[model samples]
Target: MRIVEEPFGKGVVVKPIGRLDSTTAPAAEQTIRDALTRSGHRLLLDMAELDYVSSAGLRVVLAAAKQSTAANGRFIVCELRPQVRQVFELSGFTRIITIVDKRADAEL
Candidate 1:
């Protein structure tokens, strides 16, 4: 999997371009952690190009969200494709995390 990181005035946008399975989740999580440490957790995960996510992937995302909360910053996941959205909804992740239809809708 590939991840692209973009830093903006307010936060960083993490765009995962491939599957987020167990093999890829760890690296993604590490990248996210590094970004958080540097930027204080104002993070936006742009899942527009992500194709898949496993339970391990979800854990990484959850951890990032928790880190953001602990840092008193924002974590917004936006532009989830239908399949990924379904997985999130079925796992009830959508209920616990802040998700939006677009980047503009996210509270960035």
Candidate 2:
């Protein structure tokens, strides 16, 4: 997976490309954690290019959300692919994380 970061205000927009499974979750998680540590509050994850996400990927996302809240920041995810969306919905992750159809809607 490749992590691309773009800054917005004092926050950052993180885009992950490729599959985020057991093999890639660690790297992706680390990348996101690093971004969050420096990003301050508004961390928007744009998953437009992510083709697949496994349970490990979900754990990473959950951790990031919890960490953001713990630090009094905002965490948002946008543009989930159909399969990934189904996984999230079935797992009830939608209730815990802020998900929007557009990246612009991911308000800090």
Candidate 3:
């Protein structure tokens, strides 16, 4: 997976492409944590190019969500593909995490 970091309005945005599985979940988690440490909390994950995500990926997402909440920051996922969306919904992550259908929607 490739993680591209972008600066959003008041936070850091992470755009990850390719597959997010056991092999890549740690990298993703670390990337977000590093951003939080360096950039001061708020974060948004743009997942438009992401093709696949495993349970491990979900775990990383959950961890980030919890961290954001604890730190009084926001962590949102945007532009998820259909497959990834299904996984999130089936895993009941949709209820716990903020997910938007479009990047613009998330920006709002």
Candidate 4:
């Protein structure tokens, strides 16, 4: 997986392309943690190009959200592909994480 990060208002928009699985989750987790720290925990995950996610990926996302919440920061995920959305829903992430349909809604 490839992670693209850029400044978005007061936060950062992180786009992850390709599959996020056990093989990729470690790197993704590090990159996301770095972005969160650099952006003061305000993160927006733009999953438009993400095609797949596994249990490892879910752990990464959950960790990020937990960290952001602990720091009193904002973390939002938007533009999920249908398959990816299903995975998140089935994993019970939809209730705990803030997910939006548009990046605009997630903008800081």
Which candidate ranks first by lDDT, i.e. highest?
Answer: 4
In candidate 2, clashing pairs total: 0
Which lDDT value does model 1 have at 80? 93
lDDT: the better of candidates 1 and 4: 4
lDDT of 4 by residue, 6-80 (tens): 999799999999999999999999999999999999999999999999999999999999999999999999998
lDDT of each: 0.88, 0.91, 0.87, 0.94
Candidate 1 C-alpha lDDT tens digits along 2-85:
989988548888899989998999899999998877777898899999999888999999999999999899888999998889
Error of 4 at 47 (Å): 0.3
**Candidate 1 global CA lDDT score:** 0.88
What is the lDDT for 1 in model 1? 90
Badly placed stretches (over 4 Å) of model 4 are none
TM-score of candidate 4 relative to the true fold? 0.97
Worst 10 residues of 4 by lDDT: 99-108
TM-score of each: 0.94, 0.96, 0.94, 0.97
Using TM-score as the measure, the top candidate is 4
lDDT by residue (tens digit), candidate 2, 1-108: 898999965699999999999999999999999999998857999999999998999999999999999999999999999988998998899999999998877777
What's the CA RMSD of model 4 in angstroms?
0.7
In the order shown, what is each candidate's alpha-carbon RMSD?
1.1, 0.9, 1.2, 0.7
